[model samples]
Target: MFSIVEAIRQRATPQAVALVQKDRTLSYESLFQQCDALAAMIQQHVPHDPARVDRLRIGVHFPSSLDYVPLALATLAAGACFVPIPDELADEEKRDLATRTGMDAVLVLETLAGWLPEGTQKLGAFSVAEQKVLIQRLPAVTPGFPAAAFEGINPAFIRFSSGTTGKSKGVLLSHESLLERITAANEGLRIGPGDRVLWVLPMAHHFAVSIVLYLYHGATTIIEETHMGEDLLRAGAEQKATVMYGSPVHYRQLVEAPPVGEWTTLRLAVATAAALDAATAEKFRARFGRDLVQGLGIIELGLPVLNLTGAQEAPEAIGLPLSAYECLLKDDTGREPPAGEPGEICLRGKGMFDAYLDPWMPRAEALDAEGWFTTGDLGRRDAAGRVTICGRKKTLINVGGMKVFPEEVERVLDSHPKVQRSLVEARLHPLYGEVPIVRYIASPEGAPTTMELRNHCRAHLAGYKIPLLFSAVPQLPLTASGKLKRA
Candidate 1:
């Protein structure tokens, strides 16, 4: 029965600064009041009658802002499951999510009111005075609604998967499960009342484990809405931010930008949502004197692995499992793979997600018989039990009888001084079944010729792993979360 709202209340009574933006600061008391006010407004739309036919499902569509925190907490406090519809998504995708979740209502910024579907009632409006945000709501659609399967599970939030390769699924988490995840993640993060987290990732995608972890542990969170490196560095230094969570793209920008000031208070810079390239890690450490610790974050699991110890020594290793989880690598037949042999990464953890919202894909059907969730990632553990992720099992390239991972080749291309970023993919070849091709963004100075790139790869990789062709692109496609999207 651990409540996230109650935890925030206990910490905010001290009147500390809980959240910070450029010029906006939200004290704990102000944050609590906003959450309370929003909760009351939400209760007006949801029926409290015990005999109600379905549980309330509320969708939140807003940009990354300080107001987002209170609205989400308020939704949960009002006994409605919170589903975030990112503003970057296309209108059709947003509507599809709302329809699939059977959302009972939606809360959006006043400026975006016209985006809601037609034939929906305008319930009412509310203002968050502290953040100066006006919000409106619309009623849900009842298109042959099924019995509310979610009420039985009592989910606190429903998050969609990254959908890099296929349609996304809704991953459910209860209040208790969220608490467990924060507690477990903090065991490694070691956050406290004095620490401040510099956050730049999209709130819609990363709020659950990251923002919640800082709040639960009484840490301040400095929100930077823009991806501009100067803004991020200024806030981190001025606010004396102790920790930072960003993707590899953000880290690269930080490395390339000129120094703002000495970040004496910053201790940890975590890179998640995608693989960490060795080149990025080296440049970041060389410039800032801090290792960019690579971590693995899955929708089904909060954060099971982090490279805390080996960031400088083994920049590519995802490190060992967190204290609260057990991890192993298994071959396709469910047999344990030998040490250093690549296999699918499987994990069982206390903070694992509860269910999938799709009725056709139940939780039991998704997990294995042993209760271990088989992550589609492919990795191998060294003698010291450190795991290095090679690539996704679904994305493996087969050439002749050998298996080649694109990441293995992409790392080489990224290491080139003239290459900014690179993506590797498979192409059909009548002779070898399939061969790898490299698509890259070259540095403004000049890019090496294709033959030079191939020779560089030949020096580092086996002949089968060397890419057959190299093509220059303005930029490779990336998901909203900043993970490289391979097609």
Candidate 2:
């Protein structure tokens, strides 16, 4: 029942830098004031009755910035559930998501005019809106639309799953669950008031766990405009950043950038969103004089597993499960597998999600009878209890930290008039750990060119979801049951 708002309200270090953008710095006192103002305004739009406050579902759509920090805190401070919507999503997708999630309204930027569907009513473009927060209502609610089940749990946040197989569902988390995960994760991160985190991850995708951990622990968060190597290095040096969390793509850019000044302030660098190859790790170590820590982050679970010690030598190993968490590798029969034997990764920890937002799909289904959540990733445990991820039960391709599902891409490719059948698989990339390479069988009369297929995919899918290479095959490999055989 305890929310993070209480922690923000008790700002022990009032004058300390809480949030930092390129040239702007917001002190803890200022952040607290802004959150209070925003929360007060938000409360005006909701039912005055305190009992009805927690039922409001508000969507936050924006890029990462200093301003976004308070808006998110304010949403929770108002006793409402915050749903993060990525900025790059197509408008059609946004409308559909709003409908599926039964969102009451979306808080967007003023520049993003015409975001809602035609004829949708525009409400409070609040005069007190500091971060350009505009709320827009949907046209009409569907009859008997199921409301999210938050009967016993205090739902605080909802985020979309990676949608590796098909449509993405909402993963719901409560304040207590989030607080538990962040507290558990920080046993390894060790962030505090003296530490400054150089943040480059998008707010929509990662803010809940990472940024909240930094703020909750009284760490300064530094945000830069661009992820370019020069800018990142400059910001780290200027801001005295002690910790940095980014993707492989961001690290690759830093590794390729010319050596600026020695990064003496940086103590820990965490790599998430993709696999870290030996070459990239070596180059980063040579450049920064520090090993890149690989982390396993899931929406349902908080940061439970991280590679802290093995990053320098065995970068492939995902290290041991962090403190306050339990992990298991089980075989098909649900028995613990032998050491070094590959099995599905299962976890038992404090920060488990509250529920899936899809009203029909209960949260109980995701957890086993014994309360362990089976992460679909296949891995092996060593004698030291270290984990090495071998493959995934789900075929979600990590294209430079963006999750791209082959089924989603194949659906677009199969819809092409000149395409008969299609298959999508991961191809190794030096920079991006893996990219989707597509193989398709075209119609006999006129085979579509690779460019044509790429264009077709681009129209329907996100840019990262577009296939890097395309091949026209006489026929696609099929299994005995006639399903497309994936390598």
Candidate 3:
């Protein structure tokens, strides 16, 4: 795999559309120039430690824009670790990220300049009257100077986990590991220069970076700042996006909207971060005339595995392992489970992260000697070698000694015609010890009764697996990555 900077330089072209946001479109050359300027400016203002000046840590808080991409690339060019703070994060959370990462400085768009925490220097997008004096007082970099040389093992990014279960942890990625994961995903998706990708997912997520692999192929990337259903559809149609990547929540919204008909330029769509239910998958095909490609990914590992092209035949399966990864299902005894038996899903991959940052503190843990990282997911492999995820190991419910997967009940509930959305959580039951309680959102005009949903579940799941209690909510809580919060 090529270094990210080298890949960008080689693939640069005049006609390539590097970014397409709401008001403007930028060419690859323009984007490159901006990155170069940003890199030079960053090098000038940020004070470098004598011993570690070659490597800096910069926190960036900005909306998705053509400018933001270059700022990120520029940070990497300067041999610095780029930490992206999501725009949706609370002020306290944003400050915590900066303090926790030991950021030497922060980069922000002009609008967000006031949100910077105290005791940190803020670099505005452009020089201003108030900021000019400070900008002038800093050291300057020579124009057109080359970026600092970095080894493949150098830290490129410090990405925070979604923190749905708890506080987010920072997962460090080296250039080699990041590149390997991009290569694996590119190979699995068969991404190429001709592909025009619409990027609507949050850029802070690892899966979003998967789209960067397209740069190596000289592909155009259309950025949608908002994940609103209308914005996604309009961008796809107007930009003629050939490929799109998003979460299941995004797909559900698109399908539920009024008819948009078939998208002529669309060739493939990838959905991750959450389970792509069969009903939702079918709705996507019916609305767009294309199957929403589903894959498995974890913050601990990049795109280590993906389903094959025709693997949508079993939409529930996570498909085959990529060349760089080996996946297995292990029983409680640590032995591989036989086909058709459920076990813990474990992965071994070249693209896997070196360690997981401690959520409560700053330390990390390396992988065990076995090389496999337990995914905390329960799954089973079929005779054909395809894997189907049952549910999260910790989220499983035990009902009077019978094992129950809340996801199974939730899927059944979501499949109901009147159900808009649903979530299944385990609750303590006096008689059963623990049982599944489902919280759902229903269509405003056509809501179904709890007994009706219970009957619906009976058709697909065993009695013990069905939710014993049901409640309605206006909307479900979601994490920063856009996945539903199970707890």
Candidate 4:
């Protein structure tokens, strides 16, 4: 199979610009050259086993920036799997991810490279895309899943669907899978060589698929460092950006703080990673004259549902699945839901994930008895086949579009001496859609003060995962089987 990088090189014009980050712009030829340089450095510096057929697992820990793009591409081009280390993750959380994925080495920015072990000899520092970065060799450790299983499908990226907790499923996507989904998504997006996308999302979380899509299609990606509304508009105007791919929070910022002038160049603005509020949708349309299309992007399945034709009519709808995808809404009885009624969203598409990395469940085993991959989300379908997400059935909570897992938070709370057991659940908020709240049974000694519990959690969890409210409860609700009741 032709590597995705090779495919990008095939269609791209050498001198045409491919990336714009603030003042720097890289032409297609320059981007490819940098990626090649990094790939060579990775092969030489990062350890590899000639005896093992499995690919090297390379972790990337960096802030939201353009430098991340080349490292990710170079990792993939070198036949290594890319695992992103999100900057928001705490120190312990970062260590957990590295161990869970069995990452061989991590390419980290100068200041962000503190996750390294003590007394290890580090590889020589290298520069890519004119930004200096360090390479640290990790102590050899085995991951939860077998190496052969991961290598079987030619894996490209393995990222957790939510947290890196024991219960969290590590989504494994192959090189072929990335190529397929991006091709399918672009059928509706129609992103091509001429389109420039104004992007603000962190590359670590989004680069594997979204960035690959743009590069594969020969579109220019403009990296606007700030999410500030005025800055985004200025960059869009200066770069002639044709697309805006960001979350609702970013769009709301654009709406609340009106820029001096409108971005007349944008033809499509997609709101993803969270539910798009109608207020932000309508206000953005009124201000910028571009419809805010909402798309459902899941790690298990690459972007399958996008609001292509119905955004102007119903801003809340997730719209129809692409022609290449088949979407099903299943009820509790394991049958299709009634017309215009909510059900658990299930999907089958061209580029579904290969397997769940931890505990080793393949796509065949992960799917429902009828064979569709059931997303733990609830939504309804209209007569015309347009759909909108209504609720979540899983313990995962979306805090301003970032995922916060209840089990991960509960683990931290349970570790405290003052807490015996804890339950975490999502509370609906007008702006954030949902925030995590905790209810716990205090230890026999007595309940800890809310301030004390907050400080205790702060040390272990990210700020977003820190529970919004902590309530002392006599007992947590239990189901008939004695399992903790999850609502």
TM-score list, all predictions: 0.91, 0.80, 0.85, 0.81
Lowest lDDT block of 10, candidate 2: 143-152
Taken over the whole model, the C-alpha lDDT of each candidate is 0.81, 0.79, 0.71, 0.83
Each prediction's number of clashing residue pairs: 0, 0, 0, 0
lDDT of 3 by residue, 1-487 (tens): 3357656677678667777777687788877777787778878777566764245667666666555677678777766777787877777777666666656666665566555655454344464223321221112222121123222336677778776565665776667767777777777777777788888766666432564577666787788877777777877887889998778888878777654544678988888878877778888887788877778878777766666653458776787788878898888798888998778898887666644333322112354467778888889888778888898887878898788887777777877988988888888989999988888999877779888988899888988888878898888998765566766
lDDT of 2 by residue, 1-487 (tens): 5777776567448888899987788998999898888788777764334554237777777667898888888888887778887776667777767777667767778776456877666677763325455767666555122443463577788787654444556788888888898999999999989999999988988989998898888999999889999888888888889999998778888888866756789999998866566677888898889998888877888888999978876786788889878888887789988998777899888888877766545567778998888887878888777897766667767778766667667868977999988888998899999899998898877899888887888888888889888888889866321346565
TM for candidate 1 is: 0.91
RMSD of 4: 9.8
In model 2, residue pairs whose N, Cα or C atoms come closer than 3 Å (at least 3 residues apart or on different chains), thus clashing, are none
Task: Name the weakest run of 10 consecutive residues (lDDT summed) in model 1.
Answer: 129-138
Tell me which of candidates 1 and 4 scores higher on TM-score: 1
Best by TM-score: 1
Alpha-carbon deviation at 94 in model 2, angstroms: 1.1
RMSD list, candidates in order = 2.7, 9.5, 5.5, 9.8
Error of 3 at 194 (Å): 1.6
Write model 1 residue lDDT over 1-487, tens digit each, in one string.
4567787677554588889988899887888888888888888765556887545778887777777898888888787778888877767777777777777788877666556777666777666543333333444456332456555555788887766676667788877788888888888889988998998888888888888888878888998878878777877888899999998889878877767867778899999877888889999888778888998888788988988988888898889889998898998788878888899999988778878776435566788898899888999888788899998898899999799998888888888988989989999999999999889999999888988898899899999999888999898887655568766
lDDT of 1: 0.81
What lDDT tens digits, residue by residue, belong to model 4 across residues 142-241? 7888778789888889887543222566889888888898998898889999899998887877887789899888899999888898787788888889
Show the colliding residue pairs in model 1. Answer: none
Clashing pairs in 4: none
Local error of candidate 4 at residue 377 (angstroms):
0.4
